[model samples]
Structure formats: structure tokens, C-alpha cells
Target: MNASYRGGPTVERILPNEEAHELLGLVTEIADGELAPRVADFETRGVFPRDLVRTLGRAGLLGLPYPEEYGGAAQPYEVYLQVLEILASRWLAVAEAVSVHTLSCYPVAAHGGDQVRKLLPDMIGGELLGAYCLSEPQGGSDAAALTTRATRDGEEYVVSGTKAWITHAGVADFYNIFCRTGEPGPRGISCLLADAGTPGIVPQQPERTMGLRSSPIAQIAFDDARVPVDRLVGAEGFGFRIAMSALDSGRLGIAACAVGLAQAALDYAVDYARQREQFGRPVIEFQGIGFLLADLATQVAAARALMLAAARLRDAGRPYSTEAAKAKLFATDTAMRVATEAVQVLGGAGYVADHPVERYFREAKVLQIVEGTNQIQRLVIARSLTR
Candidate 1:
């Protein structure tokens, strides 16, 4: 069967191949049957669903858009992103985790030496879940200012300091740790791959977040954690470039996520409007409510189109950083607006846990903040324009 979501087509996506269409169909089946049913319960309990993630990995959902030689599907970025969008429509936490996992894989996949690259099979295949450690407590938007130290000692680098706001913190099998290897500033940074079992690496208590409670987020402390020199993904002092490059792609992932979330909220609002009666007529029959839903629907479509356009640019090997930033900014802002409007449409129900709109609303805010805040996205766009 075609990947029909929630008894309707949210977006008319143009698939490049029959295979891509089939892949999306498989994803839809898994999301509907497996992920959707558990989202509410898991979120309510504030539990991390490690088994669900492993299930996704086993189904080959974890490794799309990477080379097949390393156990990835080798799908186009646009195709992979649509899969993410589909997942997000069902459950934002799962989608965000997938995106974060993909981001964590970037340094090793794109920059690692042959020795490190060999680990891609397990990483891309989903056998080893990953986390990224770039933001420290003192540095969030100012990533270059991270003070995590990785001092050279014989064949290993002794790592020390803490990484903050880490996704998949305690649950991940590996971590991509960015540390200071030389002088201050971005030029001193370097990337290192550390196993979760490494000595002196500790994941602190999970943060009680506003949303996405099912996906763990916390600070990781590394007290003289010894990382072998071979674990270095790229040359020392080139990590800033790697981090920036990875974020360019990662932002597009977040944009797609926003599109999916907005689409889901819009769908919920539209459905509610059509069924709920007020004053002897369905709520949707009123022009005020109808127009609001119409505007939200239009915005969702626009966000999806913009995100896909950026993905296509990346797939074409073109300069898509500016477009990605625009997509990330526009789509996330749209998600926030759409989700808020959905809550409005539901009236009292929207404010409570009875409706998923409230959860969507909370989750939408973080997308705008992570992968660089919307304000930072504006700066990236402005910089590109003048340059």
C-alpha cells in the first residue's frame, strides 16, 4: 500500500524512483504500527525507548543517504529527509533521535581515516548508536569557545571537561567528542571518537526537559578520558571546519523535521475542525476558523517545499548552506506557529495532554533553538548575502 498518513495525504511528494516510494511505504508501516502507539505512553513516563531505536536500526531505517558499502542505503539526501519527515509526523522524538544519530556519524563518515572509517558499517547500520559532544555548558551558540581539553599523551589523548545538552547521552554506544587540542579559538579544535566504555567518561543525570522526554538529554563529563590517537577523525585544528560542515547538513535535517511536525499539527487541527460542531454547524464551516486552518496548511506546504529544495541542492553537490539555514529558520518558525494554532483550534483540549498538539507545541520550540538558534540562522543568511 502507498504510505498514506492518518487517512490522508499530507504532501504530494515526487519520488525519484519506485524504490524510494517503496522505502517510504515501509517506513510508514513501521511508524504507524510501532512508533506512533508508544509515543504518548513513553513521553508520559519520561522513558527512553532503546529497543524501539534498535528495531528501527534492524529495519534499515537508520542508514539512508550514506554509501551502501558502509551499510547505508545510499539514498539521495532528499529521499532520506522525506523518511525523516514521515517519522517526525508520527513521533518527533524518534525523528530527532534519528537526525542526531546521523549528525554524530558525520565526522567519522566524512573525515575519518581508513581505520576509523571501518567502524561505519556498525554505526550506519544501527548496531552502535551515537552521540555528539560539541556544546559545553559555557558554549552553546558559540561552539568554537568550548574548553574541553584533549591533551596528547604517548599514543593517546587525555580528555577532560564536560559536554552539555547532549542527546542520547547515556544510551549511546559511541560519542563524537570535539575537544581543544591546541591554542584558543576555533583553530584549536579537533574531533575524537570515544567508545562509551572508555574510562573516565561519564554521562550525568538526564535533564528534565520541556518536551522529547523519551529521548535522553544530559551533560557528559570526561575526566582524563584516554582516547587513542587513531580515534581522531580528522587532522588536529581542522575540527571547526568539520563541525560547521556537518551542521550545514544537520540543519536541513531539522528543517525536514519541522515540516513534518507542522504537517502533523495542521492535520490534527483540520480534522478537529471538520468534526467538532458549534452553533449547529461544524467549526470548519465558520470563515474565521477555516481561514486560519487554510493559512496553516499553506505554510506547512511552503515549509516542506523550501526544505526539500535545500535537500535537492545538497544532493546536487551545490552550495546549500545558505538555503539550509533559510529552510531551518522558516520551517521551525512555521512549526511553532502551526502547533500553537493547533492548540488554539482544540480550545481547552489542546492545552491538556488529551491532545498531542500540546506536546507538538513544546517540541517545536527546541527545533528553533538547536542546530544553531533561529537568530543564528539569520546571521548565517545575512553573512552569505554580503559575501
Candidate 2:
């Protein structure tokens, strides 16, 4: 089913198509039955759910937006967006982890040589998982300043340095590690695939983040790591551009997830307001409570519109990187705001662990930081305008 906006009727209520309905059902069932039940426990423990990810892979949820030739469901980005939205409504961390996995696989699917292309059937096939590594200790927002080095040695390249804030760092089967192989700065960067368990590629302890605890962000250290020349994602010196391009689309995924999380928060808050009585009546009956609901509804709707607009531009093959940056920046910020406001609406219960809004509040913060920070998004937009 297709929905006009976030506040509008759901796809099931508006225009439920067979494909959308089926995908939604699977995501909702899995999220509700598996993720929803265990998410709090996992989050509190700050543990990664490796088996759950593989289960999604087996269910074909991991490759929903890729091409059928490569064992994907061949769904459009629009449908995939809805699937992500549904998942995020239940658990933002899980949805984002899946999104990161998909994005990590993009370089190979889009730029790999014939031999590499043949691997897509298994990679995008969901049998294998991937991670994208670009951020480093010295370079986070300034990805161009990355110091991770790759020097050619015989048939392979010796890679060294570290990549920080890598999602799924330890559990991923492979990584699209961006390294400097030529001149300094962005032009020198090149993307290479390194197996997680390979020598010299060490995933250190997972970062104890403020939120998204289960996704497992970490620093990957590479000391004299050797990468096969054939593992290059694209031609030498194209890593930065390749990484940036993947992030363009990847940001949209974050936007969609943020919108989903915000939407869920709004939905829950509104329901809670209706049920929670105030001095004389239901809190939702009062103007103050109604105003809060109105504001949250507007924010969620606006964020969804922005996300879909960016997605449509991508689908049309337009230059959508700037638009994507805007979506990610604005939508994630809105999510954080909306989630916090939702807690306010919940009053004392909001402060307690009785509701998921507390979790939503925590999850929203990471969206602003990943795929590029909000500050970097502004730079991309500004550069696009001036260029």
C-alpha cells in the first residue's frame, strides 16, 4: 500500500498493494515477535544480536532493495523505505543496522569488476553481510583527511591505520574500507574489501554509545593489513567519491528510519495522551495536549515528505546527494526533537522505562551523527548550492 504522508492513513488503510503488504507483514511480524520482545533486554545489556541479523538475511529482509539478479527481492526504494519504516517503528537500532549492512554492500554491487560482480548473488543474496568503513579517529566529519594508508606490494596492498565508529564492525563478514592510496586528501582515497577476521584487521571493543547500544559501533585497527588488489571496490583514487556516493543514498536510509522512529513516538504519545486522564478529563482533550500532538504530527509528516522527495529524486536519477543530506539532517533532528517532546507529553511515565519513547529518545541521537554528521550535511548542501 502507498501512503500520501506520515499522518495520513497507513498503506494497509490507503492503498495496500500485494508487494507492500507482504513486505510490511514480514517486517512487522518479525519486529513484533522477535525484536520487540527482546530489544529492551538486548539494549540494556549493550549486546549485538548477530543471530537476529542472520535470521533477517534468511528471511530475505536484508536485500529488499537490491536487484533480483543478485538474490534480492528486486523491490523499489519506495517499498524498501516502507519496510525500513516499519522496522524502525519497533526498534530503531535494528533497522539502522540493517540499513548499514545494505549500504556497506553498495560499492561492490555498483562498481565491482566481473569477478566481484559474481559475488553479489551471495552478498546481496543475504548469505553474507558487509560494513562500510570511512570514519577514522583523525577524520570523522572531515572524511577527506583520512589517514588510513594502503600501499601496493606485489599482488596485494598493505593497509594500515584505523577506521572508527564502524557499525557492525566485529560481526560483518567484510568491510568496504576507504584508504589513502595516492595523493593526500579525498582524491587519494580508495575503497577495498577486507574480511573481518583477516590478519591485521582488528575490531576493538564496541563503543559504549549514548544510544543504539546493540548495533555495535567500534574502531577497526589495521596494522600492516594486506588487501588483495582484486578486492578494490573501484579504480584507485576513487574511494572518497565512491564512499560519498554510497552515503548519499545511505543518508536517505537514515532519514527514513528517523521518520519511522519519530512517527512511532508520535503515535504512542498521542495514544497515551488519550488514555491518561488529567484533572477533569483525558489529556488529549485539552488544548495544551492537543497542541503537542499537532506539533508532533506536523514534524513527522514534514520529515517523511522530505525523505520521500529525496527518494523520488534518487529514483529519477537526478543529482540527489544534496537533497539526501538535507533529508538526513532535518529528519534526524526532527526525530530527536519529536522523541524528546513525546517524553514530555508522557509526564512521569515518560521519564520511567514504562514506555518505548525513552528508547526512541536514545535511538534518535545516533541518526544525527552517522552517515555524516548534521554539520557535514550542511556543508554538502552549501557546496551544492555554490557549485
Candidate 3:
């Protein structure tokens, strides 16, 4: 199967150099050859593709935007996000895992001490998988209100908390756990990089989610998990800032994933319309079907453009938090719309497992909720505008 399916609309990319173009080609080739074929089976079985994570790591895709000294490709955010889009069009679960892994690495790479940063090579190289623990049962959108606590005790910080909706959960090699260390609110928070095998750390069973089952989201209970003081990322009381900063970049990753999923749904719908017939003619020839497809295609293109614009702003060191939020909001909303329309285009056939449109529809709903909810994106944008 073609990664984008039957030669979809050509998205003209503004890559930084010839090397970036070559990298994109490599990603497309790998996505088509390795990912597209196995996605359906893995998704149907709800099995995590661990080997593919290593495959992506070996391809240098897992660490695209980080510095080369730490086993990264050092690509610009624009190029890196487009690569994610390509992968997502083929396999959303794999692409989402990559995004979460990248997010997990940011706290250490950006804020940790030199000793802590040394492990980044292994993390980025795919030798070690990572997870970010932030959301608690009581705190989903209100991250500042998280109740997980980490108390300083001589050489180690004893962590105790339950983190909900954690991606990678039990399988991650390391976890960046955000917890309270001082008073209540964001100021009391600190980030700790804890090994997965640490004593007192327990990961509950994976949630039975509506989609992305292979990604393995679960609740992690850090029952006095002892983490060395040296593992603390940044200074105490700065974890909230680090988390927010990482989220700005992560939201863009989700936007790229949304665009790819929307593109996939649009492709499937177009292909089905051309092949299926009604009234002695292809369904695509009917004005109603054709117009709907046209609108979905336009939406996909517009979302891609918006996402890329945010990525470029980030790459240029501009204040792109607002732009990223807008991209996340618009692109994810577009994904939901396009997927829903794609299902309608297929009618009953789209609802079944025989086609991927239904899966796309299910997966698209979470995009609007994760990273930051669409409602939160609006608030972020409003704050930026009003400020």
C-alpha cells in the first residue's frame, strides 16, 4: 500500500536543504515498506510494535529534531514534523509512540544536569524507550493541580503518586515523573527521571481506549519510588515551566499526526468513490460525493499548511506557543471532521473492519483531546492574544 494511498494530493514542502529532502524520501520509503503493510494486523490485534520502535530508532527517525551529539538527526522542527506526518498517514500508533517518546526526552535533554544528559544518547538512539508522567486522576487539563508528591530525603527523592493516562506505561525504559516537592500549585513541582525498574514503581493495566490500543496508555502508581537527587531535571520549582515548554513542541507533533490521519481518510474516501458505482456510474462522478471529497481535501491541505507554519516559527526561535496551540486546535478538529465525512462517504462499508476509514474516525477523536484538549488550546490562544 502506498503510504498516503494512491498518489494523494502533492503537499509541496519547504525543506531547508537537499539533505532534508533526502531524509523525507528515506522516511517515505521506510513508512511504505515497513509500516503500511503491518499496521492493520497490529492494530486489529491491539499489539504494540516494539520492534518497529527500534526500527525507527535505527533509521534516525526517533531523534530527528535533537542535536547529533546525542544520537539525533539535528533536523529542523519543520522537517521532523513532516516526517511524523508521513509515518502517521501509514500507522497512527507508531507515529504517536514516536511523538510521546520524543516528548519524554525533552525534560532531560533540555533541563537535566550533564550526568543526566549523558543518557539521552541511549534514549534518542532507541536503546531505551521513555514515558512522560504528568496527568493524575485529579488533574487532567489542570496540570498545575497535580497531586503527585516527591519528598527530598538525603541522597534520594521518595516519589509517591498516581499518574493517569500515561503513554508507554509499563514498557518504557525510563519515565520523566512530574511531582510536587514544596507547597501546592505549579511552584512546588519538580521533574525526576526515574528508571523503569525502580522499586515501588507500579504500572496498572492498560486502559481499554477507543483507539490507539497498541500505544499502551495506563495509570502509573509511584509508591515511594526512590530516585537519585542527581536525576532531578532543572531546579526544583521549575518543572511546570519545563512541562509547558515541552508541551508547546508536543502539540505541534499532534497537529502533524492529525493532518496525516485526515489525509489518509480523504485518500481512502476518494479511492472508494472512484471504484464504487451507483446509477451505472462511479460514485465520484456524483456532485454530492465529489463536493464532499473536495471539501475534505481542502481542509486537509489547510490543516497541513497551518501545522507547517507553526513548525517553521518554532524552528526560527520565534514565540510559537500561540501558533502551536492554534495549529493543534484547527488541525485536530479538521481530522475529526474529515474522518467523520470519510465514514459517511463510505456509508455502511466504512463502519466495518474491511476498510481503514472507521479506524481513522475512531483515532481522530482522541487527537482533539490529547496533548492538550481543543478547549485548552483556545484558552492558550486567547491568553496570548489578550496578553
Candidate 4:
């Protein structure tokens, strides 16, 4: 799945197909023209820019991997990774919302029967947005230990429980709710497609996050929410596997986002270093500062490479869990380090909003925590080592 990239130290130009390059161009254009200008307003006020998401949908960037018949681009994972990377570079909140939306759409798209897939046209066409509900207050990274309960009735499943830290919770058009259906533990879980307006389905106030403010998080409660049995995605016991598979794909998205974040930081640091004079010379002219930029750039390249490798594995229909975990682990940690160093390179200016390095710094921290922590990623990789 690994193919050598051509031209320059900017390995991000590499992709599995030319379509990715074209898609990334659109992403960059949109980011620079639409999102970059509004980032300060959104991040500072913690207000979600819902209108921006619709714009992304209109651009056909919302659903890249699904079949074209469903209004998707039918792009491969490699191409999708680049899109995520580009989006993250401009605004991480937008990039992450797209990632989480895709994650939320997967169970119904891939595993649900034809009836569910039929929804893909409107769903992927940007008419509908989605959220995934798997984490509970007590669960966090211990997803298998989820406590959300669902009881079956004659023709429907009565869902009763709260889902915590749901991205796009109140704003999403649909939710892929994972709840317990059997005895206990992982095997008891199931994925149900619950519409946002369903009776008894409630979205609480959005949580004030440390960063990624343009993307809001909230808790959802299903108080005997009546979901038709037909709404179930895959089979009852397959939810655990379904969730894991979606997360595998999701980790790739996060990895790409991390790459973009690191790229933004590096670009800022390099540009600032070249302009800001220090000791009667440009800062970049100093070997110490030059070497730091070099190292940060190198790490960013490595992060992009790892994510692309995993994305290629996904395109090949191979086991990508270990590789995806590795990519997420490496890329996110790199973003954190690179963002911190980027601020250091900018000195006092970096710490302030006159430059976006501070924003990049704040945004990079969450990449390590969401989509499963780096600690959880290592466990997934180590467990797969025995296999």
C-alpha cells in the first residue's frame, strides 16, 4: 500500500490518485477564502458555524468515500485523507466535524441493509448530517463498557440512556446510537439510526470545550426513544465490531487532521522565523532556529507518511487497525510537539492572537484526546501484536 511520493520535502503532495490532489485544491481554496477569515470569530465566541458545514456539503466535500450513486465522490481513503489534512490546516473544528460526521455515518452506510443505504443519496448529498453516540459518562475510552441500555419491543427497540461527549449532537440530522441490547459487555451492543427529531430523543446544552469551538459537543438522552427494529445497523451483536471498524477509519481521519495541524504550525514558524530579525539577522538564519524548524518539518512529514500508509491499507481492504492506531498515535503527538515548538519559534507573538500559532496550539491538544486517547491507541497496537 506504500508508494513513494515525488517532489520536495513537502510529502503531503503525495496521494494514491490525482483526484486527491484536485480535491485538496478545493479544500485549500475553501479554507483560505471561507474558513480562515471566520476562525477568530468562531473560536473566540465558542459559537458553532453551522452555515459553514452546509457550505462544505454544497462543495461535495462532506461524503467522499461513499458510492457516487449516493451523491458521494467515491474517492478512496488516500484522497479522503488529503481532504481532511487540508481542512484541518485551515480550521480544525471544521475538519473534525467532517471526520466525526463520517464516523457517524459509517455504521448505516456500510453495514445497514439496502433501505438504509438508500438514505445515502440525501445523506451524502449534504441534505443530512450525522452524529455517533457511543461514549457514556462512565465509558470514555472504555467503549466496550458502555452503559446505554436498549430494550426490544414488538416492532421497535426502546432506548433509554445518556450518550456523553457527542460531537454534533443537537445539530446533527441523525445519530448512530450504540446501546446495550443483550446481556452485558461488548457483545450486547447494537447500532441504531436515530433521527434527531425522534420522540424522547433529547440533546442537552453544548459543552464548553477548550478548543475546536466551531464544533460543539453535547450529551444526548434517549428516554424510551422508540426506534424501529428495521433501524438497526448490521446485526445485534455486530455493533462492537461495527464500532471498531468505524473507529479504524476514523483514526485515519484524525491522523490526517493532525498532519494538517502540524503543517500549519510549521508553515507559521518557518515564515515567522524568516521575517523576524534577531541578533542583527533573520531568526531562520540562526542554525539553532533553523534546526528546530527542520526537525518540526521532518516530524510533520513523518506524520503525514504514517497516515497515508494506513489510508492505503484501508483502500486495499486489508486489516488496518494496527496501522491506523499507529498513525493516530504518531500524528497527534507530533501535532502537539510541533504546535508547542511553533509557538516557541514565534516567541511572544505566538502566544498572542496576532498570529494563529496560539490557536494551532490549543487545537492540537484535542487531537490526542479524542477518537480514543494515545494511550488507548498503544493498547490497540500492542494487542494486535499478538495476532
lDDT of predicted model 3:
0.91
lDDT of 4 at 212: 83
For model 2, residues 63-147, the per-residue Cα lDDT tens digits are 8878888888877676777778877877777888789988988898788887677778777756677888999998888889999
Local accuracy by lDDT, each model = 0.91, 0.83, 0.91, 0.85
Candidate 1, residues 1-387, lDDT tens digits: the string is: 111224236468799999999999999888888887888889989998889888888888788978888998999999999999989998888998899999999898899999899899999888899998999998999999999999999999999999999999999999999999999999999999999999999999999999898999999999999999999989999899999999999999999899889998888888888989999999999999999999998998899899889999999999999999999999999999999999999899889887788888999999999999999999999999898
TM-score: which is higher, 2 or 3? 3
**Residue 308, candidate 2: C-alpha displacement in angstroms:** 1.0
* TM-score of each candidate structure, all chains considered together: 0.98, 0.94, 0.97, 0.95
TM-score of model 2 (CA atoms): 0.94
Weakest lDDT window of 10 consecutive positions for candidate 4: 1-10
How badly does each model clash, as a count of residue pairs?
0, 3, 0, 0
Tell me how far candidate 4 lies from the true structure as C-alpha RMSD in angstroms.
4.4
User: Alpha carbon lDDT of residue 31, candidate 4?
Assistant: 81
